[model samples]
Target: MIFIEVIKKRFGHFEGETVWQWTMINDHGMKISVLNYGAIITSIETKDKFGEYANISLGFSDMDDYLAYSPYFGATLGPVAGRITKGQFSLDGEEYQLTQNEGANHRHGGKLNFSKKLWNVSVEKELDQIVLTFEYTWADGENGYPGNINAHMTYTLNNKNEWIIDYTAHTDKPTIYNPSNHIYFNLSGKAGSTILPHQLWVNSEKFLPIDKEMLPIGEIRSVENTIFDLRAGREMMEIIKNQDELLQIAGKGLDHTFILKHENGKPDAVLFDPQSGRRLEMETEADSVLVYTSNSMAGDFEINGKTVPKYAGITLETQGLVDAINHPGFGNIVLRPEKPFKSKTAFRFAVES
Candidate 1:
């Protein structure tokens, strides 16, 4: 019970090049589009509370905007997501130094990580759901990291209004790999207003404190009375602006991870926008969740620009804590040849009465 459609585009007559566009729509009308280059999500359309369909994720209109203007919107962030302290780590008594492309620390996978590469894409359409698959092969020392890894990512949308993203990677040599999507959620729409009115709740009792470079400080600080506590489902910006202690500790906004407190099969976070009557529940197996407010979104992106001001969109990223390779207690990022490293996260959208 599957359907398939392929749309090809011209990307010049280069020797070894393949350019194409594909869209997969489920029976429930949930649609997802992907391009061969960058393995980027071109558009994702979902119905709102009013039964109106719209694109909920932020993305560029075409491939050119994706290359020049966009800053990781709706792209697969791979190899590693956050910072690598001093661009260095020691594994099995061997010290490896990564390229410091962004200032002093290695950021979002050094210069040309998975996001910048063209991936081989395949589409699977079923009776009730659609799946988009992307595969990438990385050689040893491709981006200052040691690994000959093969990564596969599957994106699926079901009739029950759930968007699931699953990642699996294996390496011939032991190396760190953290892969996730950079999909900015503006529940109100891409050109809509800020997400300050949305209600958010995270099931976490402690958060890892970080320094100015955004590296964890080897301690799990309590969030009893701190602004980091989102256990009560409060407005995100209201809590951020009013909490003086959090402002003092982490500056203007949040860019940190909350160690999830889930011990069973349930959601760790929930977000609701009353104005639109749209709700989203998140479930993941990752150890920590990083919530980032788009504090630095300039008006550089065109076509209905200037939608999100400072702290407009909120990113709920599920992954291990930042700089896990260096912190012994935080866990290790060793992917061996026999073990297939895997992680899964899901977002369920609903309409409230």
Candidate 2:
């Protein structure tokens, strides 16, 4: 059976805020709670083969905790997802500068991006889903970007235990856009524990190479003979210590975009927790995925009195490359009046035993 509860609170500069949580339960008795905030998955509780129920994701208990977290866990990122080199981009023969939130690059849509904004929430209890919508008008040059844009995010969970996230957007003017949700997963449901034991596989043969600034240097490299190779499922820890470009770029872990070799819209990656006997499959229409091992996470970034550790969480983001608008070879992320924008990504959880 599924259950839902509506919550209202006075939160963080925004008054009378509302968040709806939808709980999806399978026949096996596994439960997943998805909150409207960021379309965030607050918890995933599943019974092991031994009949022990355990949560397999990380998050805080209240809205205040989420407000303070710049971590971007299970949050929808937009306008443009990932890093934009030099904190700027050029469109229509003009260069526009954005907020330098990540060193010299504009990361995850810069400071005060879409994830931080409050969304209009809609609940569908019958479908076990929540829809969040928000609008932003760039006003010629907000954040040095262009055009007025409207966006919507729909999150749904099915009887089979799949969280379907769909994103749609339209712009009245020309602008660069790349929207995605950032969901950090820890199969063991604890922080400070390494995700090394988890087995991961990505369906990709090539990946974009980054410069010292972590910007795409406009080169595509093969994953063969490199730690980036996950074509054959391998323990994450097995490749963590390996000195490879992928690990080096992320400084002790991974934050690289893997270009899917096949674009059939099926699942391109699988992450399995051997100990829990639970698995997550990611299916999306996006062309590339940013696989990030939370190596930079520290306890100092506390939420709800709980400290989260590095390597305790992982984010798999499906979208265009970090700076797709600048690179013609990459997918086009431009939204214009004549063309509407739409994207979808889904994370499905299942028990092996």
Candidate 3:
């Protein structure tokens, strides 16, 4: 049976305000805990080969840590997924300026982006799955982005060990929109603090390289002869430790985007941990996957009561190309009233017998 629970986690910043934790537990020993504040996922627990359950998703045990130290941990990102050069973009002959929160670039919908907001949630129970739909409305001038957008994110957990995320949004005027979550997975759970022992495989032959400014240079380089090539699956430790220019440029590890060759949820990637015998299968309806190793961690955060390492987890964010607004060929991030935004990504967790 699938079970769902709602618990009051803590008090909010304002009087009479509160934060909540919603957990969905499947019969097969998989549990997912999400918070209403930022609609952030706090836990993703699954059983390993030895039939012991642990949280494989990196996050804090307290809500305060999330507010102070979260690097978009398990939070939804939007308005735009990546950096906006110099916090400026033009659409339909109109120039717009966004909040220059990250140096001179507008990143991840600004400082108080979607990752740090409260969302209204509605729960739905189907015969086999529990769906937690989180919704947030963005004002046109809130982040210097044109048009008001009503965004929706649906999280579904079923007994089949699937956690599916479906994103949908509608804008009242012509604007830009690219949304994805920043959930990092380690697969090894409490067995390991770093993702070095994990193996990753992505369904892509090319990757987007970034300059010193951490924005794409408009070149979609082939992954051949590069450490970014994980088409055949490889351990992350060797790749992360390689003296690769791109890796070093990306904070000493991967923060690159891979142009996906598959679509319509046809198995875009896989993450496995030999120690736990846990495997995570990913499928998405996105054109690209941003594979980010948590290379920027300063060893301040804890996962499962243990301090995490720099490469504590890896994020396979299925979203559009970063800063696609400036690059016409990178893919469209434009949202019009006539056309809405819709994307889906599914994470299937399993273990070898």
Candidate 4:
């Protein structure tokens, strides 16, 4: 059975509205904490091979920390995740400009992105799993997007230790809609420790090359001879230390979106930490997965009273291709009134024994 609790009541208030947090414990003893603000996954506790439970998700213990300094920690990113060239996009022969928060480009929506908004939350038991649902409605022209979009995200923790995220959205007008969860995972369960020891395997043999600004340059290149080749499991540190130009351009680490070869049930990526013997298999239906190694953390934020330095965690963001709206060759990110949008991504946890 799954046990659910409201560990924090009125965790914070946004726009004079009360926001709350909920905790769900699965039968396997996996615990997940979520907040209404940003529909964030505050914490995820799982056992290692030694049977010791620890929080594997990088986040702050205090709500104030989340409000003051959150680098998209455990937050849901939407209307359109990733960057749009020059904060501009054309839809139906008309151009629209968005609020530029990330330099000259619009990133993860806009200046007032979904990650900073409050969501209406609900919890219910779906079979043996505890499902936490978060809903948010974006008005037309909010952040300069052209639609009144209604988004629903559900987090389900099952007995098998799988945390499944289901995302669905409907837009009244034609607009770009690519949503993703930006939860940083450190299988070592130590927030302060670097995730360099973790081994990662991505099923993709190709990744989008990005410019200095971190926006995809519209070129999908092969990962064969570069450090981007994670088709076979490789330690993150080994790949980081490689003298690859792309790695140098990306701040000496990974912050690129890999073109996922598989579309459905197949696992898109696998991450394992040898020290803790903790393993995570990511299965998603999204077209691409953004692998960010937290290279720009700056060691300024404190999580659980410990300083979180650079490379402390890795974020696997599965969503429609980055900057899809600007690249015609990229996957479709348009959501119209006649057709709703839907996507699912699952993170299954286990021990390597």
Candidate 5:
């Protein structure tokens, strides 16, 4: 808990506004870069078992790249993180329609959602932690949603090598809210490297099955005998190479939500790279973890001077169920004026020998 500071560096201009990167460093020499634009995380540097540090989080260094070619990357995704069946839903007995960004579904709150907006930043440093707050407010009908919401995403980089995120929001009307950080991780630190070699473990025995459109088909099936089973920790390549029909539906990999069985704030999932001995543990207040193996990661854009192909990174999005507005018994995504939204998701990185 010795030396810790957050340094702000000028990144560049997006549109006409200047964007900056705030890099926070902790006593353990773990550093993380955050951007005011998109409220995105651009980097997370941590050590492996060999004491070598590398940035494991996927993102672009420049503002132009983030604005054009980035896939959510390390951005904060919200009002709702997953897909809405047909870009339509009914909340409070009133039907609502969201602009479709995916084929026939609404995803990540559309293209101009939280990830595209510039958020106001505030910093608070304490003896053991540095908290960065990104705030934004949207009108009631901004994205065809009902509510004026004041949302805040708080990130804390502590001496324990933990990058913790806490999401808070208050709305003036009834609205469906499910926020999640859309960060893809490649423990090897090589953008061109695939995560197929990594081992993943989820604290779930059940997963939501998806149809050909990648939307949940209203089933909470058991993962006991399926490739969705990760409770025993499975290698990514093993799961990808399986002959499961769902694999083909999701383009050869995962794009499903695993219902969490976390208890007493325990980690809901863990990912480890055996080669580097780098491990990442995640705990969240969300009901499920959206497991996306970057099934369709395009290699057109470069990162670390190399293009990362499909499965190059994996996103463990912790949030309520996808299309939760349509599935009341699955998970409640409703946010009312009387019951503001509050959620926490933490990622702890370490090296295990």
Candidate 6:
């Protein structure tokens, strides 16, 4: 059996409006805390082999850290999930300019990205699962995007210790859309510790190559002999020590998008922490998975009043290829009036024997 509860708390004010927080728990010992601001998952607690519940998602205990420079923490990325060169894209013979938040590129939307917006939240129980739905509408020309888009996301935690995220969106005009959740996970459930000891296996044979600026250079390369190869499940620390050029370009860590070998709704990656005996299986309908190690953290943010250093967590962002809007060969991220956008990603947690 699963249980759902709504606990209202003050999450600070945004745009002269008060934001709220909600906490959801299940019978399987899974608990999730979320906020309507950015529809962010503030905390996710799960049991380890020793049957101790620990919060695996990284964030601050206070609301101020999030309202400040959060580094994307557990926020929802939208409008576009990756970089668009020079913050410019053309659609239907017209060029659209976006805010360049990441140097010369428009990353994870724009200056006022979806992560900073407040969403409407609703709760419901379906069968044995508790679902928290968050809805937000973006007006045309918001952040320089040309569409009045409505987006909805449902986060469901079930009896099987599975957290499923369902995303759907509709647009009034033709636009590019690629939404994803940026939840960094540390199976050890301990902040300030690196995730290098974890083992990772990505079900991918190819990965996109990025330039020094961390933007995709329109090349899809094989992961056979490089450190990007995780088919046999390598320790993340070992991969980080390799002197590969691609890894150097990404701040000496793994931050590239791996092209999935499976189709939609198939298992894409597996992450296991031997020390904690916690295993995570990720399945998604998105075309690619961007695996990012928190290399830039460097004690920048405080979690529970303690500093969270670099490589504290790993992010498996499942979405369309980076820069897909400008690259015709990458993948289709265009959403027209006739067809709405839909995608799903799920994380199944278990104790490995």
Best by TM-score: 5
Instruction: Give per-model TM-scores.
Output: 0.91, 0.88, 0.95, 0.97, 0.98, 0.96
Q: Model 6 off-target regions past 4 Å? A: 1-6, 263-266
For model 2, state the Cα shift of residue 191 in Å.
Answer: 3.9
* lDDT assessment of candidate 1: 0.76
Error of 4 at 22 (Å): 0.5
Candidate 4 per-residue lDDT, tens place, 29-107, comes to: 7899888889888899999999999999998767778878858989999888989998999999999999898889899
| Cα lDDT for residue 249, candidate 2 | 70
Clashing pairs in 4: none
Error of 3 at 338 (Å): 0.6
> Residue by residue across 1-353, what tens digits does model 2's lDDT show?
53433333332333466665656665555666665555566776766545677777766666777776677877778778899887777777877888888887898777867776666666555543433333444355667667777777776655566777777887777888898877778776544566888999999998887766778888888988777888988888886778776577776788889998654664689998888777899888888999888878876765335567677777889998779877878879888889888878878877687
Clashing pairs in 5: none
Residue 116 displacement (Å), model 4: 0.8
Worst 10 residues of 4 by lDDT: 1-10
Residue 165 in model 2: shift from native, Å? 0.7
Runs of candidate 4 exceeding 4 Å displacement: 1-8, 263-265
RMSD of 6: 1.6
Model 6 agreement with the true structure over 1-353: per-residue lDDT tens digits:
54555566887788898888887777776888888899888899988999898998997666777877767889999879878999999899999999898898898998778899989989886667788899999999988899899998999888788989999999999998999999999999997788999999999999999998888888889998888888888999997898988887888899999998984554689999999999999999899999999877868567876688888899999999999988868999998889999999999999975
Count of backbone collisions in candidate 6: 0
Off by more than 4 A, model 5: none
Residue 140 in model 2: lDDT? 55
Distance from true location, Cα of 172 in model 6, Å: 0.9
Error of 4 at 339 (Å): 0.6
Say what the RMSD of model 4 is: 1.5
